[model samples]
Target: MTRRCIVLLSGGLDSMLAIRIMQEQGIEVEALNFKTIFTCCQDQSAQVARDLGVRLTVVGQEDDYLDLVEKPQFGRGKGANPCVDCRIYMFEKAKRFMEQIGADFIVSGEVAGQRPMSQKRRDLDRIAHHSDLDDLLLRPLSAKLMRPTLPEREGWVDREQLYDIEGRSRKRLIALAKKYGLKDIPTPSTGCSLTEPKFSKKVFDLMDAPGESRRWDYELLKVGRHFRFNSQTKVILGRDEAENDQLRYAHQLSDANSTASLFPENFLGPRAMLIGPRTDEAIEFAASLILRYSRDYDAGNALIRVDDEIINASETEQAKALQTIAAS
Candidate 1:
């Protein structure tokens, strides 16, 4: 009987190498890609799976994923990323996926000590033991340094064929990729927005707001000029045409309740969308941010609109009012 394994494919060098190693050892491999609203590399993962000729399974977090984001059991990383908790969630799901598909074990591209949050040796152990896949989970890229898993003990896989790569170095992984005849390699990145500091501020902002934040709000953080008006209010101004459309799209998200979306009604300025209470003060604030990005001071006054209704304000007045409003 051919042993089966599920590899967590993240469309990165390490993950591709992990799948390749499993295939070389004659283990049937399946690719699993887990997505969150904050994750931006799903397309890469899908394309990599297609290139590797493995059947791909895409899974998304439940609404409860928000619950974990709000408060993680292992706390958060540098940003809002609950790395340890998030890994536990993914691995726990992977465990169920293995049972459902009758796979003998699970594999990942994780290199010990490469990542600060969840790839530390201790963190890896906690993730495995807590997810209840202790001996059933394997990290082929670093398998030689760790204890052998059930698959190795049962002779379903050759322990000698696995690697023992460690730390944050990519030299070995790059070399292995070349050996495997892989090309067009992707640059190494955490592939998660949660790992970024600026992005995390917006995430933290959304989480701190009451009855206003949702997945939609979080997703829009990836595309805009984010400005925190207060703990309860924010205005995202689009920097260009692409962002302008995104701002429009964000306004239509399920949980968003902005009273009016502000746009450049008559000038060549940026389009700004408001999220939070749309009081007269908030609308004025949004207008002020819109003016800050405007080059239409020569137009004497710019006519801006909210919900298709126009408000004409002099460039100087708008700027002065916004500064006063922001300070108050």
Candidate 2:
């Protein structure tokens, strides 16, 4: 029987290459893509799997995923990315899939030292051990540099045929892609928004704040122009209509206490939402951010609407709010 393998395909160059490498070795490959609320690459992953002609299974993040996001066992990276914990969650799921299908082992495109957070050699081992894969997890790209896994030792996979590539350099991977006759190679990117510097700042701000609920706060991070008004309060202004709608939706997620979702009552300003302990001060701070993003209509006063109430905001209030919002 041809050895079956589960490949974690992130739709990136390295993952595509990993699947191809397995195919070249005559291993039957089933691609698995993990999806999180914050992950942006699922569509790309699906497309890439289709292009590769592999049967792809997409799995969603479990509710317990929020627990990992809140208090990651391995902590966070530059942003709110709990990469190590996240990978462990993914591999754990993959292991279940592997056993369900009677696949011999798991394969991944992970290259040692390629990513600062989760791709370190030690982190890789930790992830495998914690995910319960131990030596059952194989990274073909860096396999030769590390110890042979169960797949290799059992003759399910050929150890000598695997490569020893390491580090962040893609020169070797690119050459291998060429050798595999791959026509389109994707440029490398972490694809997680948590890696973005600005996004990281928001994540840290949330982490430092009190009473930060996991899923609610994480959802807010995905939308709006975030501004920190103070340690206790921050504002998110919608950049467009979709974001405007998102603000309204986010505001409804909690009761009147958790978040005081605010809107512009009088003016043609953008929608603004706040996630924090709602105080009178926090509400006003949120109001100010709304006015800041509002366009100056010919009318001096703008009508702003909060949940059930409306307030007429004057130019003076708008200006003060703009200053406050900018200072944040």
Candidate 3:
């Protein structure tokens, strides 16, 4: 019988190379791609699966995935990314997938010592143990340096064909990609917002907020310019026309957390969403921001629309000052 394995395909050079190695050894491979709100490379994964001639399964993070992001047991990296906890969550799901599909083992592209947060030698052992795939999980790119997994030990795959690649250098990996005739070698990137410093700041701010941040709050982070009005209130301003439409649509959602939407009624200006009480003062503050960003700023006290009612913009100085403080 032909051996089969499930590969965690992240649409990167390493995962693609892993699939190639499995194919070279005549092992049937199935690709699995995991997605979270912070990840943005599903399309690339799908394309890579097609290129590799492997069946692909796409799985999204469950609500519990947020728990790790909010408070990672292993702490975080340079950014908000909880790499160790996040990988454990993914591998746990992959274990279920492996059983569901009757695959003999699971494989990934992780190189030992490649990633500071998640791919340390000790971290790899912790992930395998925690995910309950102790000897079933294989990292083909670094297999030679680790204990043989079930596949290798059982002769399902040749340990000699596995690699000992580790660390941050991609010189060997790039050469291997060319040898395999793989095209469109993607550049190295985590493709996750949680790994970005600026975005991490926003995530940390939300985490530090008084109340628990909802999924909607996290989703909104991708859409607008966020401003904290107080412990109970935040304002989001659209930076472009498309984002303005998104804000309008988001505010109208049945489960939206926004209390009010603001825009310039008589002049061109960016739209804003209020995520807390739409008090008169908050509305005025939001409108003042609209005025500051409006194209026709001198169009005599900008007429601002607050949901259905029009209000004269006020608190211009206060809004400007607050924005300055936030930026600084």
Candidate 4:
């Protein structure tokens, strides 16, 4: 009987190499790509799966996955990424998929010590144990340095063919990719917003805020320039025409938490969304932001739309000063 294994495909060089390695050993491989709100490489994963000639399965993070992001057990990295807990969540789902498809084991491209947060030696062991995939989870790229998994032990895969690659260097991996005749070798990237410092600041800010941040709040992070008005209110100003349309669409969603959408009615300015009480003060504050970012700043009193009502811009000086303070 031909052995089968499920590979966690991240659409990167390492994971692709792992798939190719499994194929070289005559083991049937199935690719699984896990997606979260922070992830931005689903298309790449799909394309890689096609290239590798493997069946691909895509899974998404559930709402409960947010619990780890709020507070990870093993803590975070340089950014808001709770990588250890996040990987555990991903593998737990992969374990279920493995059982569903009757695959013998799970494989990933994780190289020990490559990632400071989740790829540490101890972290790998912990993730395997926590996800209840102990001994069944294999890191093909670093298998020679780690303990043999069930597939290797049972002679389904040759341990000699496995690699000992570790650390942050990609020299050996790149060479291997060329050896495998791969046409598209992707550059290394986490491709996750949580790993970006600027985006992480916004995530931390949302976490520090009083109320619980929902999925919509996280989604909003991908668009607009965010400004904190108060503990109860934050404003998002679209930086471009595309973002302006996104803000308009977001504001109209049935589950939108925004109190109102503000835009310049008679002037060229960015659109904004208010995610709190629609007090007169809040509307006026939003109006000022519109004016501050508008191209036609000389328009003495710009007409601003607050939801369905049109109001003249107010407190221009105060809003300009606030923007300066925030920038500083």
TM-scores of the models, in the given order? 0.90, 0.91, 0.96, 0.96
Compared with the true structure, what per-residue lDDT tens digits does model 3 show for residues 54-167?
Answer: 999999998899999998999899999999999999999999999998999999999999899999999999999999999999999999999999889999999999899989
Ranking by lDDT: 4, 3, 1, 2
Candidate 1 structure lDDT? 0.84
lDDT of each: 0.84, 0.82, 0.88, 0.89
Worst 10-residue lDDT window for candidate 3 reads 319-328
Query: How accurate locally is residue 318 in candidate 2, as Cα lDDT from 0 to 100?
Result: 57
C-alpha lDDT (0 to 100) for residue 73 of candidate 4: 90
Instruction: Find the candidate with the highest lDDT and give its number.
Output: 4
For candidate 2, the TM-score is 0.91
- Candidate 4 lands at a TM-score of 0.96
True-vs-predicted CA distance for residue 199, candidate 4, Å: 0.5
Residue lDDT tens for model 1, 2-94: 999999988999999999999999999999999998887889998999888899998998877887888899988888889999989999999
Kindly report which residue pairs in candidate 4 clash with one another. none
Give the true-structure RMSD of model 4: 1.6
* Candidate 2, 1-328: lDDT as tens digits: 7988999999998999899999988999999999887788988998998888899999888789888877898988877889999999999999999999898899999999999999999999999999999999999999998989998998888888899999989999999999988778989887888778777776667777777456667767777788776777677888888998877776766432236566665446688776566676677667756766766653355666666777655556556675663311
> For candidate 4, lDDT tens digit of each residue in 74-193?
899999999999999999999999999999999999999998999999999999999999999999899999889888999999999999998998999999999999988998999999
